[model samples]
Target: MSGVDFEQVMQAALAADAGVAGIVSRRIFPLSAPKGAPLPFITYQRVSGAPEAVLDGDAPCERISIQIDAWAKTYGEAKRLAKAVRGVMAGAEFAAELDEDRDLSDEEARVCRVSMDFIVWA
Candidate 1:
């Protein structure tokens, strides 16, 4: 909706859990991470969605999709961070739903990554 401020949604995401904070050290990237940044951090981006028609000057409800990813040196650490994220997003103020989670490991890079997809209605 044009009247709906998506900043509030971002704030809710940042306030999800203290455990998530501890893991990422408050590093939540809306874009890209800095060069040579350390591991065990979080990154998120808003995915594109279909356009909705607005009728009678009434703003249509917003359906926002976000992908949150956690990168760590160990699989267990990544899983823990992902779990914390899930716990917080599940109780967000908005109607947020966790769609899926994909966990990956990079043996060459010696890192584990967990990606979580979420849809929030505003």
Candidate 2:
């Protein structure tokens, strides 16, 4: 955690996976996607995790809470993209683990979205 680049680690893990790379082409956005962008993309945000304390001046254990979203034109595609994301996250060594998964689709926008929450400890 002291010398770790959390975001780079996550991005590298995702890019290294063939399944995820093929689907999204490493189009993982931070915060939001571009206007009039293409479908089948990913967006993620980092939220602050709960504070931690340690006795005897030990390095405190901290966690990074990240929310990942997959957006596509169809439900199946969105789900596939999410599955790829989950796979990458699961196989990574950030001390990251899955927390929750949610579906957030908008029919009017013709966009299918799947949200996944994961925790990485430092």
Point to the candidate with the largest lDDT.
Answer: 2
> Per-residue error at 24 for model 2, in Å?
0.7
lDDT tens readout by residue for model 2, 1-122: 45765777787788788998898887878889999778888888887765466675644666779998999999999999999899888777765788999888887898999999998885
Across 1-122, the per-residue lDDT of candidate 1 in tens digits comes to: 35656645664566556778778876677656676778888778888544455766635666778888888999999999889888777776775699988999889989899998988776
Cα lDDT listed for each candidate: 0.76, 0.83
Candidate No. with top TM-score: 2
> What is candidate 1's local distance difference test score?
0.76
lDDT of 1 at 21: 79
